[model samples]
Target: MRTDLLILAGFVAVGGYLFSQVWLSPGDRILAHSYNDHYQFEWFLAVDTYNITHLHNPFFTDLQNASVGVNLMGNASVLGLALPLLPITLLFGPSVSFLLAVTLGFALTAFGWYWVLHRHLCAHRIAAVLGGGFAAFAPTIVSHGNAHLNLVSMFLVPWIVRFALRLFRTTRPVRDSVILGLLIAYQALIGEEILLMTAMALGMFVIVYAFPLLPDLRTMVRPFLTGIAVAVGVSLPLLAYPLWMQFAGPRHYDSLGGLAYVTNDLNTLFEYSTTSVGNLGGTLTSTNYAEENGYFGWALLILGAGLALWLWRDRLVRTVAVLGAIGLAFSLGPDVGWYFERTGVPGPWKLFVELPILDSMNVGRFTFLTVVALGVMLAVATDRIIKASADGGVKRAGVPLRLVWAAALAAALVPLVPLPLPATGRPPVPHFFTSGAYKQYIAENHTVVPVPALKATGDMTALTWQMATGMDFRMPEGYFMGPLGPDNIATNEPPPGPVTSVLLDVAKTGKAVQLTSAQQADMLAELRKWQADAVVVYRVEALPQLRETLDPLLGSGRQVDDVWLWDVRALTRE
Candidate 1:
């Protein structure tokens, strides 16, 4: 117990060190590599906190998309985590809460795997620590740690795996099924994509593990099927509504298009990630800093293969190896690429690219299953080494076998040690929001149309400002994924209205255009549709031009507390 506490403390220390940049000044600094996703998640936390406190619907909000509203369940809102951390968000603000979520997310995930390995798999505690550490802090996991709280909060995964294995052997199938069902529901609320991937991986494992024991499967089939049925019965009731809201309710989207093209390059499987200690010159591939999902390094890959070969007799080792290989193949996506060039080779994922749930996922994340496979292999190998050492040791060619194995493990892992995530100082929220000045100008549930309004692709500063105000005012056409086009496919930004398109163009080009009377009438009509109360422009390079552009439609604006505002309640009022 004492040793477990120490190991957990070590994990926490590592997690804290990795995020110390934002931890020191949560509100003022942001993860540079998050690329505005930090603002999006902070907005999620703030809105969830506000909704919970005010007794509003947590699944939908008019806060970002204004009168049209955004379906929170359709987005990666992470309400499962947000609701639990409400006190922290309420006290220290969402920035602090966001940071805490990522920081502790890593620690808790590591500890969860550690507990699983020590209690069920490895005989030695240190072996479990190594395996668990790799499972949680692998390069792929660290990449998502940039701003993907939904992916980072994986503490439930190991427990889910443990319970799943128990179901195959448990006498008390009813009790175990209920527990597993509850866990599945919670994990679904956290990140349904992750849960889906886990289910796929578990299914593959069960198939592979049961193949050799097919003759005895008849004995295990009854309990396994019964437990699965009961588990489904329990989880469906808890998840039915939220699942409906996500897929069939207001603002629901069919699927995100073009994600099938975003996949891992073949070389990514053996290269070092930018965040890893072993990176020589960084990657030359097209993957962005946050999407380097398969950089396992050559040493780890070779070591994993060697370990699997050495333990070939063990069914578990063979099962994990097959799983990892399949996952790696799938991660290559529809067309396999070699040295960042398309090879025109169809990978396994090509067959499933158009499937309902799979279409929405970034296929490169299939490498997550590979990470789990490697962790299991490491634990099993380490257990063998410890047992060999204890039982008078196995010698090969008179070499010190234990010492050689230890050195080999270190060689594989040392290069993969993670570096601190990059961060930069974020601009402070405008005084207009912090002083609560907007409340006086904007009526309840009325929109504040920000100049250069939050779009899917660029500048999300407005989101931080809205979060700073505790989501007190609504905004039009903000950064969030929602249904669009004839098919209602998922798009990051809603279709821009006539006025919004011109504002966005001005914000992008810094060139003002004169609006004719007809255009002004269109702008007014759009504002009326939004039920807009005010149009506020904060710090932006095109502020002057934007003001000139809006003048004809909104009349001359007045300066107020580091912002220019035009109160349009008269024109927009019903």
Candidate 2:
């Protein structure tokens, strides 16, 4: 018990160190590499809290995308974590809540895996700790931790794996299955993509593990089938409505197109990630910092292969090796790449790329399964060494074999130690919204048109401002995923309206275009269509140009508490 507490404390310390930059000034700083994703997730936390406090529907929100709304279930809302942590958000504010969620996410995830490993796989506590630490703080996991709360808070995964393993051996199938079902439902609420990937990995592991036991499979088949059926029966009721809202309901999309192409380069398996200690300021093959999913480094890769060969006789090791190899193959996407060039070879993922749920998945995330396999192998090997040493059988030339093993493990892992994630200053919310001064200009059920407009990409501080106001007012063309066109294809943000397009152009180019009479008329028509009550512009890039663009259409504007405002309620009144 003392050792477990120490291990948990160490995990928490590492997590705190990784995010210390944001924690130092939670309200004023954001993860630098997040690329506005921090704004998106902060808004999610705030909006979820608002929904719960106001007794509104949790699955659908009109706070973003205005009257058109956004399907909350269709996005990575992390409602399971958000709803439960409402008190922290309500007390300290959403920024603090977000920080706390991510920090505890790392600690709890590591601890959960430690508990699982110690109880089920390892006799040596240190072996479990090392394995769990690697599993939770792997390069891929740390990379996602930059912005993804849904992916970061993976404490439930090991528990799900534990219950899944029990299904093959348990006498009380009904009770265990019910528990597993509840876990699955909760994980679904947290992150459906993560749950899907985990299920796929588990299926692969089961198939590989059970293949050699074909004759004995009959004895396990009945309980396994019964457990699966009962688990589904329990989960379906809890998940049915949310799943419906995600797939067939209003604002839902069919698939996130082109994501399957974001795959790992083969060289990424041997390269050092930018965040790792081994990074030497050279060419990095990853798509971006957040997607450095397979930067395991040459040392770890070689060590893992060596461990597999040394422990090949063990059924568990053989299965884990096969699973890791398969996972690596799948992560290469539909077309394989080597040495930063396309190999023109069809990868394993190509076979399943067109399947319904699989089509939506980012193939790069399959490397997560490789991380899990490596963690398992590490724990298993460490346990074997400890047991052999205890039995006085692991000695080489009168030197402890464990000493040599520890040095080799350190050599593999020390280079992969993560650095603190980068952070940058956050733009402060405008006083107009923060001081409730906007209420004087805008009416309820009317949208505020932000200058340059909130968009799916580029300069989304408008989202932070909206969240600061407790989502008291709505906005059009905000950052979110929603269906577009007749086919309901998923778009990052709704197509920008005419007024938004012009404002965005002016914002980007820093030069206002002279609007013709026809263009002015069109802009006004769009304003009326949006039910716009006011136009607010904070300190944005190319502010003068934006003002020049808006002046002709809205006639004039007045400075009001760190913002320029043009109230259009009179023109839009029905």
Alpha-carbon TM-score of each model against the true structure: 0.97, 0.97
Error of 1 at 94 (Å): 1.0
Candidate 2 residue lDDT tens string, 68-134:
7889999988899997899999888889989988998989998998899898865479888888888
Model 2, 270: alpha-carbon shift in Å?
Answer: 0.6
lDDT over C-alpha atoms for residue 407 of model 1? 88
Q: Candidate 1 on 293-354: residue-level lDDT in tens?
A: 89898889999999889988899889989999999999999899987798999999989888
Candidate 2 residue runs with Cα over 4 Å from true position? 280-283, 391-393
Clashing pairs in 2: none
Task: Please give the lDDT score for candidate 1.
Answer: 0.86
Whole-model Cα lDDT per candidate? 0.86, 0.86
Superposition error at 378 for model 1 (Å) = 0.8
